[model samples]
Target: MKQMTTIGWREWASLPDWGIVIRAKADTGAKSSAIDCSSIEELAGDRVRFTLRLSLKSNETLTLETPIAMRKHVRSSTGHGHDRIFVETTLELGGAEKKILVSLTCRKRMNHRMLLGREALAGSFLVDSSVDHWATPRVKKALK
Candidate 1:
């Protein structure tokens, strides 16, 4: 049997490829995960380049270029549909690394920079919403 790790409603995660640590919300209600990005430009051969703003106050940003996994039309909680660019990347969470599909969207208004959805959590995690940072120690070690 696979040992599923327990995570909280919110947790810290690292995107090693982008060299950034971000706070992510484990939302079981969402079907697909999303990442906050700005100035997304589609390149040739189904590739995209974008700048990820780590902090809203800081001027620092990480630029990344990756092939598009797919373009998905996601409906929001407000029943609004949006076409988002999807990309596959390595997500380091709870000392476990998995390649997951992430959609790039403007999330300035959201509390967390990243949202870990059902697809990313399937067969891997069991959420304990009452707790927070269940994997902080492990995640910190993985980041170092």
Candidate 2:
């Protein structure tokens, strides 16, 4: 059996298409991974559209329009939480890449910007609450 590598409680992550990098809190308390999003809409066919507003530890802002390949209703941290829409995307960390299923939601009230939940970190990263960004190096967006 293959062994999974571990990660710290917090790390710097990049949303490539969004042109932003944000400090992500690895929350084992959270069941599903979530990203801060706004202007969500259901497009024709199997696509979902939304604008991703990002903030890094540096407090830089970047807005991106992303077309989601899939969307599904998912449960949340609280009991019987809002039905969120999931998007299939690649999360690159610690020089390792994996395709992760992330749920999109309006996180206007949240502080950290992005939350990497248990499901997303499972079997891939082991979190140490005492540390921050010990695994993945901060990656910036590609200029297109």
Q: Count the backbone clashes (under 3 Å) in each candidate.
A: 0, 2
Please give, for residues 1-144, the per-residue lDDT of candidate 1 as tens digits.
Answer: 988888888888888877778888899999999988999999999999998767656656788999999998999868999999999988888878888999999888888778999999999888999988887643533211
What C-alpha lDDT does candidate 1 achieve relative to the native structure?
0.85
Best-fitting candidate, scored by TM-score: 1
Model 2 stretches with alpha carbons more than 4 Å out? 16-20, 56-80, 137-144
* Model 1 alpha-carbon drift over 4 Å, by segment: 137-144
lDDT of 2 by residue, 15-130 (tens): 55444556678899887788877777777665677766565333344444445645556665556657667887777766666677777787766776678888778887778888
In terms of lDDT, the poorest run of 10 residues in model 1 is 135-144
**How many clashing pairs does model 2 include?**
2
